[model samples]
Target: MPQTCFELCAGGRSRGLAEIVTGDGNPRHKKVLQQDLECDIVGRNPLHTACVLGHSNIIQEFAKYNVNMNEPTTRGYLPIHYAAAWGQLDALRTLVELGADIHAVNFLDEIARDIAFRYAKHDCVEFLDWAEAKHALQTFISSVQSAVTEQDKGKLHKDEKLRCLSACKAKNDWLSNVKNPTRQDLINQKQLLEDTLLPYLNKLAGHPEIVKSGKL
Candidate 1:
């Protein structure tokens, strides 16, 4: 008789490797790993660990076996995109060095940069910005446009206003320390700063909380 045990490796709990690489890993992975490059493994195989456990180390292991680091996930996002979105800076760098195509439309870079910013990982946010701009992807750049449009429509909230202000200032300070940002990136930064002013101005104009909080 032969072994027949297998384990699931979705984004939820899949550590990324043990289920696929480890010999003692899930038995079903053997066939999946052997699939051709064009196979639909994203939904079928696991992408969770592709950018995990230190982007550099995991990518290292993949390189040892000549895995396609640039391969897209089930949703069309490359492994670097996964690394970017998940705050895996080491992983992001590894994929890049491994020749992962950074210019591709990666939803993870857009989503992950925001996630990193929200968590105050300013370095990663800046890296994503540079990478996107260098690659001319315009993914994160478009997000700035969308945020501006929302603010101009007066559809933004208090927290959103604060976040925009922070992002704007941070973007400016970051640019001043590096090579000059493109006109588009700088323009977007200015717009974000201007957008922050509106909500604050509106609140100040009618400051209902001023009388209630007693701290104002």
Candidate 2:
């Protein structure tokens, strides 16, 4: 008789489970792995179970199987939340790299970072904080890129356009080369954009003459 799904998981046979579920092993076992097993009575899926076990290899296999990384359990705890709560830093990092929503809220309205803090998982907390700031910096960079494109299409004065272009390019270059930026680095960059390029672009966008001419 073949070992059961629960048996395989309990033994940490991630490779065997992957092969069975993906049909690389006995094709009949595929259906067995496909059915939900109630996830040890906690409403977790295989992916969530893998996260709780800190089995990042299993998580990667699940991702290849198209499992929803952000799927919430019955109580609204996402895989990220489980990883954070259990102090599974590596598992949490794997989830993040696999596109898990860092901002996802649990039933208690707590984010993964909040849970990490509550559980005294300082490493996970730091990683989540940095990830959020990096996301914000990336968003700001995209907006600056868009603004530069729009400025090229606008009817701003030659001097104004040159100034904006230079500033945007310098900021973009600096941000691109930034490595392991702290929160303060992110905040300062945002402040610079708001004070300089963004304000100039906003002024151009709101200018009555530019708006009337449809050149903003």
Candidate 3:
């Protein structure tokens, strides 16, 4: 199959190879790969075009070249925003797996989920919602672990350490079992964990060394 302009431009292929494969013989085509060229009309980069076309393979190719996955277009639309707007679920999933920021807002202050919802892309909306919730839960879990390991070391009493560890285990278990958690579920669990750990966190805060470490 013939490579699209996006594949040729973003694939990081040699100019000679691109010329041979594309057979376009346009010098601007060479410049397109050598320099990150934007679309004339919308000013979208090659990665954005790949997402708009729902080309997951091309998106992965962009990743191989260390292309900025979260880089927005001239209009402030990320590759993810393009995928969401175009209802490209597979492309969106690829971007998410590659660590694209799902929470990023465009110039219009609309997140990818908002774009998905506006376009009536229910699957994309659901996936973005779940992805955001999962990311938040994982971040909270990491913070809890870090507090126990880095912040509370030698500071928390044995009983307090046990309590924090128990709470962490419960959160891990909850995350393991959760299939599709809502944002409200994340908020509730976070609040519960905060309530459980607030006393210990406060105790740590009182320690001059702990406060100095800035890990709290």
Candidate 4:
């Protein structure tokens, strides 16, 4: 079968791709392409094909249109998976920048990094390792921020207050210890924070008077 018009346009990364997709009056073609355009051969959509071909220019075009970066192929492999498998570092970074989920796993339960490793793409693995660690740190930071808000504003029993305060102090200490820390440092510190706080939070959740108590 010949390549779909969308695939040709995407593979070429031409402005014509956008023109063709948007100018189509059918609407369904654009919708189906954006959401799910499965290829019988590779089960890859335009975006997936762009990644496999390391067509960063085409990917930038998709990013402009806010294309679905996480769209999975027939094998449940996302564009990032193809980028990793092909050791396309620029494409991988572009995907991540455009909000691709680094944690996304394929049908084989393998993440992008895992696929990179399987292919012995050492540089890709290194970049993925750093990206994963950075993502973990950012996630931990967001969680800690939310936890802090809960500690400060959420109603808690007096005993729970002390526990929250302790957790806060521990969080502060962990922050203080890290001075321009690397990704591994953040990973380790995040684990420590979780260990110190999660149990206390769980225990506090079991308190009988939690809901009844008003904000202190």
Candidate 5:
């Protein structure tokens, strides 16, 4: 039997929400979803119900409307927790790809991966492992990119502000004594000294006539 939108939501029908909506950005429909449509049996929302039922298509439809994947139940269990507990591999994978927190803990202080492992869902456990590794790699890449950008900015400032050869020589002498200095360490030292040195360097470079006359 094809349940109506209200009936399906209230009853936790897995295919109800997706089948009802046009997915064309309807405001009324969005409002309906935003409401607390609790399933009488399980007390879960439409998205949570679909997750427990392992309905990937329904989950995708919910995601189209920017559904909250981390929405917790009364028990503080997220959709990811249900997906793992029910051994719904596809549902779990879809949630992970959509940026759900794989490490999120439930009310019982149990993570989704731990629940899947306890339920002996070996495939889900393996998928979670891969997902975690992929996330870590992406974070590392982003940090490296930021560091490169900072280094470039530091080099530009050094070139523009330190115009006098004597000023440059003084900076080099200070850097040579810093133990275990990395590229970032050099940039930090340059930034710390920039404000103090820029004005003096600018004065010396501007008054070339005074410097040539050797009048101190």
Candidate 6:
């Protein structure tokens, strides 16, 4: 019965697709298939403990077994989605090659790409660019605190200077990317970044290098 299946799935060293489907496969994939088993079946849980503990090797083993790569859970995430958010490039690539749906959304209505961007996970961004997913902007917007706000005295100007430098590299950054930036928008997110940092930036405005740095 399904109860037997659930109990078996909940308390085994490893379970296979056949076992899961037949109420007689391995129970936990935490070990057995670790060498090389249908990891898609074993490593199926999204952002699960298995992914966090040894996804790098687990991903490779799954490849050896021809496990369904990038198979989406009910939450619409593949193993790759979790690996990316956690900065596991090797696991991420394995999932991608297996054709994981890069654009899949999570229960929160936010997609993996958005998770990488909002959390400053740059490595994940490189692969997720084409997969950019959007929730209602308002839902997403409400989750962030003031981006550049921090209260350390010596660090505010330094933070602003970096913000300016980061923006300078990307023309759109200076003209518009941070805070809805675009060359035509012309609102000066640099100023906005500094404003958030103002509690600290203002204290350094009178300093020569700080002013010249435009940190204030």
Best-fitting candidate, scored by TM-score = 2
lDDT of all predictions, in order shown? 0.52, 0.74, 0.75, 0.70, 0.63, 0.46
From the highest lDDT down, the ranking of the candidates is 3, 2, 4, 5, 1, 6
Which lDDT tens digits does candidate 5 get at residues 157-207?
Answer: 444433433444565566456565544555455444444344543444533
lDDT of 6 by residue, 88-111 (tens): 656665566555666667766666
Name the regions of candidate 5 deviating beyond 4 angstroms: 1-16, 22-43, 151-216
- List ranges where model 3 is wrong by over 4 Å: 1-4, 7-32, 36-41, 150-155, 158-216
User: What lDDT would candidate 5 get against the real structure?
Assistant: 0.63
How well does each candidate superpose onto the true structure, as a TM-score?
Answer: 0.40, 0.74, 0.66, 0.65, 0.58, 0.37
Q: Work out candidate 5's RMSD over C-alphas.
A: 15.8
Candidate 2 stretches with Cα past 4 Å from truth are 4-11, 36-42, 144-179, 189-196, 204-216
Per-residue alpha-carbon lDDT of candidate 1 for residues 110-183, written as tens digits (9 for 90 to 100) = 45566557667676677766655544323333343445445445645757655654664575466657575664
Better of 1 and 4 by lDDT: 4
Model with the higher lDDT, candidate 1 or 3: 3
Residue 11 displacement (Å), model 4: 4.4
Question: Residue 95 CA error for candidate 6 (Å)?
Answer: 1.1
Q: Report the alpha-carbon TM-score of model 1 versus the true structure.
A: 0.40
Query: Which residue runs does candidate 4 get wrong by more than 4 Å?
Result: 1-11, 24-38, 151-216
Clashes of 5: 0
Ranking by TM-score: 2, 3, 4, 5, 1, 6
After superposition, the stretches of candidate 6 with alpha carbons farther than 4 Å from their true spots are 1-50, 130-216
